[model samples]
Target: MLNKKIVEKKLTSKTYTPKVLKELYKIFNLRTKQEKQKLRKILLELISEGKIYKDSKGKYRPLKDNLAIGTLELTRNGTLAFVWTESGDEIAIPAEKLGNALHKDKVLVEIIGKWYDLPEGKVIKVIERGLKKIVGTFQPRGRFAFIIPDDPKIQYDFYVPVEYFNNAKPGVKVVAEIVKYPSPTRNPVAKVIEVLGYSDDPSTDFPTIVVKHDLPVEFPEKVLKEVAKIPEKVTPKDLKGRRDFRNEIIVTIDGADAKDFDDAVNVKKLQNGNYLLGVHIADVSYYVKEGTELDKEAFKRGTSVYLVDRVIPMLPFKLSHGICSLVQGEDRLVMSLLMELNKEGEVVDFEVTPGVIRSYRRLIYDDVNALFSGDKEAYRKIGDLKEQLFLMKELKDILRNARRKRGAILDIEGGEVKIILDEKGHTIDIIPRYRGEAEVIIEEFMIKANETIAEIFNNFDLPFVYRVHEQPDPDTILQLKNYLSALGINFKLPKKIQPKLLQELLEKTEGHPLRSSIERLLVRSMKRAVYSSTNIGHFGLASYAYTHFTSPIRRYPDLVVHRLIRNFLKTNGKLTKKKIKELNKKLTKIAVHSSKRERTADEAEWDYTALKKIDYISRHIGDVFDVVVTSVTKFGLFVEIIDKYISGLIHVSTMNDYYIYNEEKSILIGERKGKIYKIGDKLKAKVIKADKTRMQIDFEIYNEEENKSNIN
Candidate 1:
């Protein structure tokens, strides 16, 4: 018999070196073909056990040098996970290869294989558990219970002992503290620690999401007390060294729901026919000092989470919406930026300083847009300020043209939606969000301010938090090109993708029926924007330097930026080498933490919005709506309603008749009737099911069927 133990001992020896399979066979003296085959199988088993790794040269070696530690980030469906190493390499780990590692668990992975030339790995050991508690619904069965997690990335239902229920009733949302992690043969064990509320109640939505993402809803006692000590209004002492722009026609333009105004702007046409744009942002750092309890809490939250029905401010409401808010007719301290531009909208010179600004007017986006569109009431409301408004619009157009000329991406909308809820917390309407001229003006001005601030710090060689978006992966772009080609839209794959390349593609499909679909696909091909200590530039904005500096009231990075700017101004841009070194190290940690928090906030908001959308759909079960097939798969077709952009799955099993999925053609043909379903195909689908617990909405094609619900 071939001794597998001997093979293991050989690899674990003090001086054993990596060897090829043939060399290992010779060393083991396996002359018989069957013995050699057995040796190969043993080696494979050893590799699977994380005892060895196959190098690029096809030689087997120990896993020590090939090991990388990172958080095991599981996909939503839990079929796979990825570990992004410190070296910027993402290693794909199949579900079976995870070795019982849960989502977000810090684990050591050994690179063992390759998937399409990308590094693939297996978790060898769990270094640390990243998730402390899980939010889920408690379900009791006789003596034991299970908590089904709200997060889709969590694959296993936690097993809870009867005594550990913590008085949580069945079907209530609860927070479960992880008692023991899951092993290969056992499920995770947890104890119910906190009961949120009834799982199915409409009011429970906010708390559920808050617990699910572990977001803070209330300020700590000390932090609250600290905030109470702050002044209710800006004082003369606070504005002593700051330039005052209270009398300027500075105005804040935002949505009607906006309570906290962070930025206000004023514009002027100078003697040289150049435009002077002044952007004043609320000075949040002036109050939220570093190393304080309030500051610590803000750092932990990283960013404010804006959801369907709530705003989880980074700072308390006192600072976010009161003392720091630049409301109309109130004096507010700010860190201001003044940019001088000629007809071409190029920044000829700029000034960054601390200032005091009183917003002369609070303008809503709709009203401003209506005024620019020649609405008589909107125009009449602004009186003699009409000249300044015209100048502002002109400056906006000039800035927009400059961006386009510099190859900046002009159009890529996020498909945002505004969900209106009734008094009973039921979704009454879902209005698709659109950007008008006023919104665009604010966006352009913010981008310009962010760029200028980043450039200032970069020139001073200071460490700062930057908003970065890397270029899209070449493989993703190639895939997009293939998809477009299949749609008969001939797009040439470029060797180096400039910002204008994607814009051109979007323009080419301007009036096509699949324009939105193509835009979405193109957007996905691009990289996600993130906070980073290192500057890589923002590919989406086509900016060489960019950072968020206007929303200090809501974003922690902006607060940090504000502090840094204050320090620069106070010391005349001079800092000790030690301070710079300390900042460089600290900012890296801040960047990583802020990026993660931002992603969590974004996901939580999406989940809440989707839940409401699903809530609305469930009430109108059996109602048919026009849908366009967004994606075609072997299992089903994913479709989206045109107007509201609500998506649902048309499971293949619901098709009454079995359909043969044609992968190459990206279509499904009915076996009995030859009915075809393909991407971009317009069809009417009846809403069959909407399950909130599972976060699923399902539809079935409405044809000459006996009844609508029969397919369900």
Candidate 2:
């Protein structure tokens, strides 16, 4: 009988063109009626998969060879780009050739020409629209209204009629549902489904970001009911076949504001002078079974989102913060990784099993850091646990040294902005959140556990999701080399680049004036890390195998790993072929979905942070601050405020004299005054404008001499 692959092969070959069903059957030499029926089914499947299309006269043909499938990325200026999913190559699409496609839409494009030495293409068909609703500000126009979308990539404003205003007033933020998609001659028509409120309201900004990104913020009633049925504590039956670690002095170390405690650690010295490390993570899979309402919702969320003001948890609070959380003095069900490491931080042996643990203490990062710094008060707070903490710290240092020796890329200069809000939820201050030594200890331990678990699963040949980070493309490496050369740094990049080369360059430029800018460029040149069912070595970590085995309470992929481990244990460490295949398929889908959701969460968090920073700067208009030039472009100099670390643009128009941009040297030379501005140059700038709606801040050079003279 004919199958989908056979049909595709026949259609793709040049032996025949489009043919009717009878002609296709004859080409394949099918005789029986059943075989013909199978051929028909195969043709339909091929059409559904977009591998081939049926013509108006009912003949099937393969899609154009020049056609490539990818997602359409639209820039703020309405320029379009198509990023191929398979090759990761991007092709430019002129605005006129974009047709009706929207931002992030799944599109098929035909390669046309070259623009700026890069491939260019025209979108032929939009397979799927990326947006159903948009968050924007409403501008009323007498009888009709329009919404200016908050997302800059959305080029067209959605037109709304008078009756579809949803009682929203002009200048009010709203969520507009698209009723009619845009065409060549017309803009998109939409109806206001919700009115968020004024743009100045700080409370409206966060929620607008959430809605704009389509984050799953609320759980369904069925899922809530399921959460209600869960018990508050582990039962005796639940502890069956689980290792008992409740007697051990396990401790959970986290940030001060953290609520969901998923992982706990314990360490002790063995008789052979080796260290035994215990990493106990909450076993959420034991309660949230597959295909359940809770599981579905958790899978949809993928991971907990840590926004500035709140947390949108993957699981409900009852599970994430109550039962599954490894809270202090709480008996919880956990999946633990026990490893025996030599003094040199090499893993000698390891074991993974379901365990019941009772955490003895919950230590905050600040206290632990102070204790390590020999603070008497912090040591007194830890009391008897000081020795264990010291041992953990020693082990962490050993592990870190081992990792560094193995050439792990450590890009660690960036810090998150900590937004502080007033009682009315208005932004008051923005500060940097620094990661201390205590946080690094926890991170090293988790990475070790993840690598250990991934190695175990890989050896067993079981289906599992791995945290894979492929090496950077050669083009990216060449670009970095060019940029560094322009900066007067003589670093030679090899034809085949590795993480070690990047690491060495970073070390050489550690204390340079352009260190931060170089680090930022290097990071941008690397590929994003994501999850995959296949085992691709993690280039950034210098590890052959890696996976997420901790924080099951917050991350859905960790829960999946726990489930796979639990199933292996239940089946006596053996899985059938059928079960393995099913698991492989399931894990693949999960990896893609989880990676996408994680990206969405990251975008939302960044947008919210940018909004808060703009709001904070809005209150300080006309204030002068010291800034460092991060990059010099033809249009302006991009500068970062030294104190606040907030980046803004200093336009060339704001300069006192005309400046000529030096493309080769990446500097700006004042034509009249001969003043020069380059990256890493420090100057003072006064804030001129802050547009909260656009999330932009404008700055003008501050003349210290003129200000001093005025003061005199």
For residues 66-127, write the lDDT of model 2, one tens digit per residue: 66666777766776654444334567898889988888777767788887756888987776
Cα RMSD to native, each candidate? 10.8, 4.6
**Candidate 1: RMSD to truth:** 10.8
Hey, what RMSD does candidate 2 come out at? 4.6
| After superposition, candidate 2 runs with Cα above 4 Å error | 1-78, 82-97, 104-122, 482-489, 511-515, 576-578, 708-712
The 0-to-1 C-alpha lDDT of every candidate, in the order given, reads: 0.86, 0.85
Return the lDDT, model 2, position 95.
88
Q: Work out the TM-score per prediction.
A: 0.86, 0.89
| Candidate 1 lDDT tens digits, 57-132 | 7787765767876677899989989886533457899999998789888777888988675789998777568788
Query: In model 2, what are the clashing residue pairs, if there are any?
Result: none
Lowest-scoring 10 consecutive residues by lDDT in candidate 1?
47-56
Task: Score candidate 2 by TM-score against the native.
Answer: 0.89
